[model samples]
Target: ASPQSGYTLAVLNVGAPAAGMNAAVRSTVRIGLIHGHRMLAVHDGFEGLAYGKVRPPGIKGGETPQEVEGTPRCRGHPPRGIFHPPRTLPKKYFEEISTNISNFGIHGLIIIGGFEAFTGSLELMEGRAKYEELCIPLCVIPATVSNNVPGSDFSIGADTALNTITTTCDRIKQSAAGTKRRVFIIETMGGFCGYLATMAGLAAGADAAYIYEEHFNIHDLQ
Candidate 1:
């Protein structure tokens, strides 16, 4: 390997953040370490990596891995200076991210997110041949309430959002039940997907719910 940077299994999410992200990160790190692989936390998705665009310098100090505040961080490393935002930079300004996975002995990558995540996974899998000298396997984890990712029927954040919506609806029902014959017309979230509204309605035993998937009518309750 590339003189052993003392790390293994680089991971990051390129899509929007979800509620289960930190939890997934925790599990991924603890498990990878237990399995004898050191972990590197690539913050801010591919953008964080865009900075790594420049050929990564030779693996330096801290061959010994250590933990700080329940999270492992490299010691004796100076903080990075200010740089341009990820989006604002032109192709000319972008640094060339080092592509030396085999040298680092990285065996696999774990990606977490929704639809965007799926696309990123495909990109990595497709570029396996040209991107690195060694082939790296990839695992994609779904983490969103939208539950719209292909090939998977469910996602991590769906349950969390379901619980929250159910509880809130229950509270609203309790507080406003006192008003007799008062038809409560509560507006719910979930722009294109109606899973949230449908589940909240079922969990809360709501008298009615207007979801986007199935035709909903206001006159039904009457």
Candidate 2:
């Protein structure tokens, strides 16, 4: 497909920093490019979207760079920006975001982040009724250590985190066994979801695991 025959799409990262964010963006950009779409990488998340801080990836200062080259293939620190509660931002900001989208001629958006990405996409979907510019295609890719995003069994960076925790737990258990310790408590990161802790505990062979989904009292712990 010719460049002129392709859609103008944007990809951005939102919410807290997470592993595998750059890889997601690279895949999005590469796939879009292969399909001959014009891909713009927006920095700083939604704030960048509102302010129009975007440029074609791999373009230094070209008048019109055609393709994004040398996209990062490793884990990247995701930008933590542009995350607000649904319908909490001032109306004027939404207007600006819509206006910027139109100005940039972005026909679609690919948001890569955690639960906040899901909420952000829904917020934009809700705005479609009021702002036609926001009616464009939206895609959210889950990439958080929390693994809290619904509709998916696992998120991008979750497995990596789970492995790290499991391995660390093994080492701690070995040290404790050598010292003749009876009990040890390990913690993992998952804001409201218990996926990480539960999975790590099982993998590390812990006697018990506590999570947000299951309420536990002092008696339960005992």
Question: If scored against the real structure, what TM-score would every candidate get?
Answer: 0.67, 0.84
lDDT for each residue of candidate 1 in 1-222, tens digit (9 for 90 to 100): 123335467666545545666567667765665555666655445454444421222224533222311121122232432111112211221223334344445566676676666776666555545555325667778877777778898887788888888888888888787888677766665656787887788888987677778775757657
Question: How far does residue 194 in candidate 2 sit from its true spot (Å)?
Answer: 0.2
* Model 2 bad stretches (over 4 Å): 1-3, 59-92
Per-candidate Cα RMSD to the true structure, in Å, reads 7.0, 4.8
Pairs in clash, predicted candidate 1: 52-97, 53-96, 53-97, 54-96
Clashing pairs in 2: none
Compared with the true structure, what per-residue lDDT tens digits does model 2 show for residues 1-222?
A: 435545898888777756677667777877777677888877667776776777777644542334444232112423333232121222446798999898889999988888888888888888888999898889989988999988877788898899999889988988898776366777788989899989998999989999999998878775
Using TM-score as the measure, the top candidate is: 2
TM-score of candidate 2 on Cα atoms, chains taken together:
0.84
